[model samples]
Target: MSDASTPEERLAALDLAVPEVATPVASYVPAVRSGDHVFTSGQLPMRYGELLLTGKVGAQVGLEEAQRCAQQCALNAIAAVRSVIGDLTRVRRVVKVVVFVASTPDFTGQPQVANGASELFGQAFGDAGVHARSAVGVPVLPLDAPVEVELVVEVD
Candidate 1:
């Protein structure tokens, strides 16, 4: 029940295998470090450059599945961070998370869906997980993913 683990220890304890970095489909980089902070581009629910699911949340994709997609986005963000810092422990704290959910016009549970990513961060970074976050409903996302997540983290 306790997601308490130092960043490095969490990687080892959870077998936090970092996935391959997702390629950028545009001019933006996956992540960028400035001073003690790293900001990542919005990561879609992708695996190997392919979207895992596409469509509007609460319609073709259920909230549960969208939650899973959000988790995957978190995983992708972690991978991006590791690509730069080489170690998860270098992360000091998750500063912010912006989760965008492609939603049906009437959907209003974006925050709960974004909790998927927020919870993952808590599990992976413990106290460092507390962060400013925004869960916004959008008309669409690139590649039509149900959810996309971007992170801002402070690192050593």
Candidate 2:
């Protein structure tokens, strides 16, 4: 089996640093592993208990900023994984991702915005980063945050 050190080294080589875990907004666990898969709870664009950005995507929040929020959500997901397994390198593959964009009524660029999280995973894990995904636009999110992301990872 590949060791955590290998992936950690790879992340360092790629100049990637996993951000600290975001605190849960309510009363749900961040991640739960069953057999070989880890299911992460929805992650918002929060830093230090505060939403990084508010309002709907494509309205008050620009696409670029929403994309950045997506990236932050990915970071938060990784932190949840680490909290459960003790090391991100133990993640064999990212199985799936669901990205939700709190969007304006006419916004239709959900997939493009979700690429922010997808790209970050690719940068951090290379081939293992690729995964099935769903990007959907909604009218609102918890705390009126711009974006939220959740992940399912296959680990050993």
Candidate 3:
């Protein structure tokens, strides 16, 4: 996969398109490249400029819906990464992913929820996408989004 085609082509193969990087909701930029790494800011499950799901998982939101939301967050993060790096093909590997799920106090399926993002990365990058990850249950998220994801990638 080291010689894989441009990321836009890879995403097109999956019937996906990198979105225009969502406008930042606050003071932070969407991503930054430092040396050999690109760090994406936390990305909400927003599409077409709207939050797709909201509320705490295991409560107002169901596990399945939250999982899907996580996928959208991952896609948004990739868009953010691309905005900074200029091309997904520049990514050498996904180093780490951090997914935050807003949850009821009893919800313990954070890891499963996070797989939504992991699976997408796998589909897009194959072995290069496998990454160290953290799935955390949080009290709430900005815009009341059910999930958010951020990425740390090593780039050429």
Per-candidate TM-scores read 0.91, 0.91, 0.94
Query: How many collisions between residues are there in candidate 1?
Result: 0
lDDT of 1 at 9: 64
Q: In candidate 1, residue 3 scores what lDDT?
A: 50
The residue-by-residue lDDT of candidate 1 on 15-97, one tens digit each, is 65457889987899999999999999999888877888999998999999999899889989988998888888788899999
Each model's number of backbone clashes?
0, 0, 0
Report lDDT (Cα) of residue 112, candidate 2: 87
How would you encode candidate 3's per-residue C-alpha lDDT over 78-143 as one tens digit per residue? 999989888787888999999999999999999999999999888777778899999999999999
- Report how far residue 87 has shifted in candidate 3, in Å: 1.2
Ordered from best to worst TM-score, the candidate numbers read 3, 1, 2
**lDDT scores in order:** 0.88, 0.87, 0.90
Error of 3 at 108 (Å): 0.5
What does candidate 2's lDDT look like per residue over 61-134, in tens digits? 99999998998898889888988999777888999999999999889999988999998887777789999999
